[model samples]
Target chain A: MTTVGEVSRPSRVADPDEAISAEELQLAARNHGIPLEALRYDVTPAGLHYLLIHYDIPDVDPATHTLTVDGAVARPLALDLAALRERPRVTHRVTLECAGNGRALLHPRPVSQPWLVEAVGNAEWTGTPLAPLLREAGVAPEAVDVVFTGADHGVERGVEQDYQRALPVADALREEVLLAYEMNGAPLLPQHGAPLRLIVPGWYGMAHVKWLRGITVSTEEFTGYQNAVAYRLRRDADDPGEPVTRIEPRALVRPPGFPDFMSRTRMLRPGPCTVDGRAWSGHAPVMSVEVTTDGGANWAPAMLDAAGGDWSWRRWRFEWSPEPGRYVLGARATDASGRTQPVEQPWNRGGFANNLVQRVEVVVVAE
Target chain B: MTTVGEVSRPSRVADPDEAISAEELQLAARNHGIPLEALRYDVTPAGLHYLLIHYDIPDVDPATHTLTVDGAVARPLALDLAALRERPRVTHRVTLECAGNGRALLHPRPVSQPWLVEAVGNAEWTGTPLAPLLREAGVAPEAVDVVFTGADHGVERGVEQDYQRALPVADALREEVLLAYEMNGAPLLPQHGAPLRLIVPGWYGMAHVKWLRGITVSTEEFTGYQNAVAYRLRRDADDPGEPVTRIEPRALVRPPGFPDFMSRTRMLRPGPCTVDGRAWSGHAPVMSVEVTTDGGANWAPAMLDAAGGDWSWRRWRFEWSPEPGRYVLGARATDASGRTQPVEQPWNRGGFANNLVQRVEVVVVAE
Candidate 1:
């Protein structure tokens, strides 16, 4: 058993034959992904949204909790929930995907949250733009990074600390960045980070810190555990690895028909069926979505909905007519930058940013 | 691989040493349990409330949805959402627990949802009482059971059908029975059976059918799959087990102190601490809650809060000052009917109604 202090060692990939540890199961039970069927909704409901709380949700009293801006800022300001809400509010339909969305699918799984492909949600987040707040506080000219600290506290890989992450000054100053307090027009739910949380549109969920409490303008580069040690793509334990950022181009098909209780295998009648799904990319606008009914052997373009906001996912649909048989349905997306989802993602030590094409097995029975 | 028509065989208990199957992991990823920390709230928030969707969340259009009452009822009628909301309204805080909550904890686990102890939530359900509606429909005196059919349709063990369950006439007519359309003071989210659902206050969650659309008063007992085949306590494949019903007494402690990310083991400085949790029972009001620091060897009574409503859980707390060391904390509850939570629940084939005592591991370090 790995004790508290002993967990400081390098990340351990589970043995291929080993069963999921009780510890991983514990995390999976608490954090959940949006059910693939939920893709039917234009905006994911608050409760059905994918949630990844690194630690315990800090108890924040809305009346007393305040956001403190300090460090290299010219004017260190403390804003309460009411003050933040009084600012000009904007709502954006943004898609957020966890960096470890496909961690459990890796061959030697990185032993963390054990997520499959379901860890993604698109929601309308309402809040004041973060750039204006930073401008009001007057960021120092030499400030290289902005560090966001959340009230959630715990030990990650043996380091005892509050959850913290740093964003490059340019990214922090982006107009789309927000101090969101509402999700889907409702005050943020506790599990979704009530009081306040950061929303970095177009970035993976890790960049959007939850239960945010502090913003520190740092002259020096901020090297926090979350940004420095975790959420990195590495080949092995010894590699320093590149920092993971942005959502990779990926597409998922809402399982077309009803599912079997235990196996979740899709069972549908043989006929013409219109399959639809949502696709998104953080690097650039999703340029195209492709569907394949016979795995990846053949592909056809799917009609895309008129582009949604720059950060939200776009819906796409493909028409298919098939005879009664077993078929593996696959969907893949390509961004304007020409980045496309891979058929097989390379294995990484931390299991970060594995965006392989999704495949759903469907059995069309003869009616 | 189990295909569409091939799953009609007897239920299979997974090998004790086998890893969780892809199917079980798929289910776990889609459904979620309330984080134990959520126990802090009096009423579980809508999103944080545990959810278990047996199949797909039926895409319901509230504007067009209607509830039909027929069968042994003299006046067959269809009530639209507006008509149902025109009736007298009542709100109740009810605690619902899944029958398979501790299934994965069993030695030869049932190959289904694979839930731990977290599949329980207390929430406020608002709607009109059911007895009046039945009376308005003029149910015949010969009606022995009322059958509920939900919009959610799927195959369970090769049986393809809309989700359906039956309740005895007396239980269905209980004053507290409701046809709930709202949860936590808001319209039901799509995943939670938008538009309408049934709330059998004191019964297991299986009885509170989601996406409810029809009610049929039956002359004879309805031997539907859900009532006679599923959700039963069986000794083996051939054993005709007793039907699982109301919840058993159980207590859950909110994990204290901070947690290690991967292991979720508690790390707190040695000092005086208040260990608090919630306890409830459907058979009777919870009479006593006991706390233990050294596993289950020694036990002490905890203070209970003033009783909430009849179907809701009551809060309890225990104070302790312990020295620095590792200790396993345990909590158990006993109801007014003298039914206490078992230390180790007897294993059943379907893994229903297994309410074992909850044990949390904690490491109290010197400050």
Candidate 2:
């Protein structure tokens, strides 16, 4: 995997595996369960995506590693990275998102990871529960928030840069988050958030801090660049215009977009056909997903899997035999919060907050 | 720096100062400029904290490296790493929190990165904004969330993993979250989330995925494992009776509990002695913090800096000239939501959400 020093603008490597056939590259993306559209590009190709690290990548040899928690605590706790690993390990397949995953769409597009379409992906993370660590830390009652900082740095406001964010002490002690040292069944690649990345499943990617370094207990707020200026949302240029800081309940279209543009004439059987896809939301299990045959005009409720946690996508399918003609297939999702997909795309300068319904074009043929 | 594989159950590294000094580490955590806490065991040490990566870290070797954005849009965007470096750069500091920063604190703590307090950190991130990437991506009206996936992997539910998450299309395009390849005036390290880590300031840590592999333009949410489960607050705990799957807004206590053999006698002082400390909240900025000098008798308001974003921590200070003796110093914080710190701590099976008024005993030398 690549490291911070190794990462470059998309154009450099262009294609990491150009040696492989295009068809194979596409297949690889698919085999990796990536959206087919993601593989369409070649040189740092359009729509192709990658991930980012928010901190300095530290170099730790497995032999000498320790985790300690002290200060404002009952017992100054110390645990080696090995000891942490020795604890019972619990694993889960969750997603780590970049708060600006879709920021490129925003107008005056911010100067950052020039992500197009493939900025995000799914992974199974494994680690011990953080709760035990806090227990080991012997959290003091007065602690307000546990501030976590990373080893990465950059100048912010002309000052030496180091990033940090705080989680409520109560929340910090939760068991869901992990001091993850592995990703997708492998040791974290330096380029993909190597050892000790915070895996916060339900919130936006910002919540999943990478290049993790220090955790301090404090009774105040920690303000840094990424924590203050980025990943904010506005409510349609509406009244009061307050940014939504917390991860709003939202769902995603799985097998996102059109899948390699299935030839309408080829897959066309003048009989009832099944339109299938996946749906998922942050935090809550997906409640229901609606399918729109003709845009939003006619809506048919799609069958969905039993509600799953906000951690995974829910596969949904709708059976529909299209008449011999060209038509647009759209899907709208709704979570437990009743927040459904919007028909009209939100117009933002940066183009963030894109929760538009999924529209796919399909044609039917009569032999 | 430490890699995920390098992080053992218990870390072994000694305090900072070797690579990153402990005082500087403490400054990184305590400095109001970017209030961050040193998490981990101090092992994994401040300099060796784990790093997740995104967009391979691009030092460019200065002689090589290029970036380009092209896709199903109106414009084909391209830039070499040099061009990106040359492009106007905007710098800002904010907190990048892991959505699951407090996951370990959740009840029935879900299985994942069992990060205690070490999952989060603060840094002064500097890099080009992502807005240009969006412009390059040619975001369309149909686009929804911008998805991000990293190169890291682990097994969850018996499946190989890749870290993934999504940002609102708008946020993803913002220039604040940068394609940061540098850290504190240096190229990114392999473990420090090198190359380009999304600086989704103000959001949780998960949003800033590391070891970036790809970015995708989508009309729906990016529901990947790391993005899905890592960051979440269980707004619904159902009365300590039923098991909860989510985390709640919480706080951590430092110097947890009081020191043995010390009583109020050690706290009383003669004149003009200041009792100072800090306070913070997750997902909520500290609005006002209060100090109780008389064991809850008389409350004095602590000075607070202007509230920035919700992801960062607020620093507070209070001055009190003690009457010549030992006295207990108590401090509490309140957020914009009118949520104030509790006098007594809240109890949970996981020992999370332990935010309570902090009491510190200080001895004052009478003049």
Candidate 3:
């Protein structure tokens, strides 16, 4: 990507394929993970979005790539990118979540990619509604599950097969679900799963398969490793645990006025200050977000902008005049389904969806 | 520099000349500012040293590079690299300090470059003693200050000139002050002033002029722009301010064992854990270092490793068994001269030499 010439301001992600050497690629990975402080930016620039690949992000060429829909269908269809783009296209903003966003906060931290609150991002996706595509295929009555297969294949948890996950036929036919082709008005970057990917609005990233290859409507439930074993929030060995699906309601605060996060301690001028962030929930739309500057002693309502649509993250802002001293900045989000973030989320086996309140320590210097 | 192939392991710095375009150069400048977190590595490698160039680093050819000593010297001498290397050489480990190490922390934030605490580094410098060179040239009794000039030129504070600083003749004559030609056992890198640099141990980096061109023994007290207008701690407009010198006593703790810093918060296990860090003082050798995990309520002495030398930094370690919870880690250092780090350094107009206690916030997960 051609970045503007500033030679000082940093961007989030780089093309892994073009990176000079293995060391340069390594440096790119570290440098591109945009710190959540960049939340102040309205549309998290393309590559700067948080990355979480289940196994591999197999490269796909748009010219040769095609999507095959079969099994429990009256007509099997193999549609190429040109044909897919020709269908009625819809653009919608949605927030994609990793499901394991707060895994690092879990005590006795469970198995999974260790992520803080940064494993989430809001972006605009342009695609054809999956319900229309599934309707055109004419699903049979016996079909119970729709399994999505990605071209990216690897042995995860000893299962040597293409990465697969199944959605109950009912959720698969939801009008909000998308066969996404574009992100934030631009074609997807490779690290973000280029060519074709799913955009399961209101669901964690695992449900949104990248490098889409095949769609199989199954007669029986498909228990893939991702759905049945990995991504499960297990309480104990006996409990098979509930599969992680919908994104948990959560919010993260950035010190307002957009300061450079190069420093460990957030410094502020002791006067009129603002705290702002983004809040998202998959179960329902975010209703409200609250912020506390004095360690939860008193919370104040924050203004939230939801113009991006129901499934998209809302920008939250709060203004406060603070005195010169140290303060613990805290924020909690509540969703339309009445799910408010907890003070301390219970630790689970795989550390999925542990969205405790987000807190940041800030120091106010004399003005 | 050939870095060993560990694709995921992060390094502090990289060559800027090879970066793609000026944008990549800016990115390299930002990404290469080695995070303060890299201090976990003992003896920061040559290229990984923290860099803050005041002006463009002019390239100097080793074949033609020479140090010209004139002014009040009884006999002026211009010595080339080979001639200087013929003299007795010594390699010594010393910590270099930037006068603006904590400029960002200053209230009203007075400087253009808002440097945090990562502006310091320790390295092994190989060179002949400056005192002996001056002694051979026969220093005149009238010499008051030894002025050092570097080839780097720029317009700083609206003045266009090559960088320059001065040291009192007494301090310049100290045996430890080195006319360094090599760094960390290798010839100095271009960014590091290549042909030669002055190593004024126990003093801030302003005293260590890189790309050394000329050294003049001034009969009158030197009043250069760098010495008179910058690197001074001023409280108000009328205050001429005291020139900042000598690295202050300070210590930074790295988690006991090497732990990945990918987590937003430093992750540690419950039960016995060790934490270690580096400490140094300019006025004298670091006599003691203490750590406080309870936010300054209590202090515990830490074992220090200082066998390297008086001018070198001491590695300090502390063992603690912390209960599962959140903690604010703090460290302070004391020097043999009885100088101790303060809890809060008073604010200065120019934002120079802010050395307060260093604190790190960490999380302890249950095992």
Q: For model 1, how does the per-residue alpha-carbon lDDT over B1-367 read when each residue is reduced to its tens digit?
A: 3356763334689986887777788888888998999999889987888899988999989999999999999899999999999999999999999889888888888888989899999999999999999999998999999999999988888888899999999999999999999999999888778989999987899999899999999999988989989988899988878888899889999988888888788887777999899999999999999999888889999999998899999999999888878888989999999999888667899988889888898888654
What fraction of the correct interface contacts does each predicted structure contain?
0.64, 0.00, 0.00
After superposition, candidate 3 runs with Cα above 4 Å error? A1-34, A256-263, B1-367
- TM-score: model 3 vs. ground truth: 0.50
RMSD to the native, candidate 1? 1.4
Candidate 1 per-residue lDDT, tens place, A1-367, comes to 3355753344699997877777778889999999999999889987888999988988999999999999999899999999999999999999999999998888888999999899999999999999999999999999999999999999988788899999999999999999999999989989888979999998899989889999999999888899888988888878878998898989999999898888888988778899999999999999999999888888999999998899999999999988888889989999999999888776799888899878898888765
lDDT of 2 at A32: 14
- Candidate 3 chain A lDDT trough over 10 residues, lowest sum: A1-10
Clashing pairs in 3: A7-B26, A8-B26, A12-A32, B256-B274
Candidate 2 ranges with C-alpha deviation above 4 Å? A1-33, A36-50, A54-60, A65-72, A76-78, A106-111, A114-119, A155-160, A234-272, A307-310, A323-326, A346-353, A361-367, B1-367
The number of the candidate with the highest lDDT is: 1
Candidate 1 chain A has its poorest 10 consecutive residues by lDDT at A1-10
Count backbone clashes in candidate 2: 307
The docking category that best describes candidate 2 is incorrect
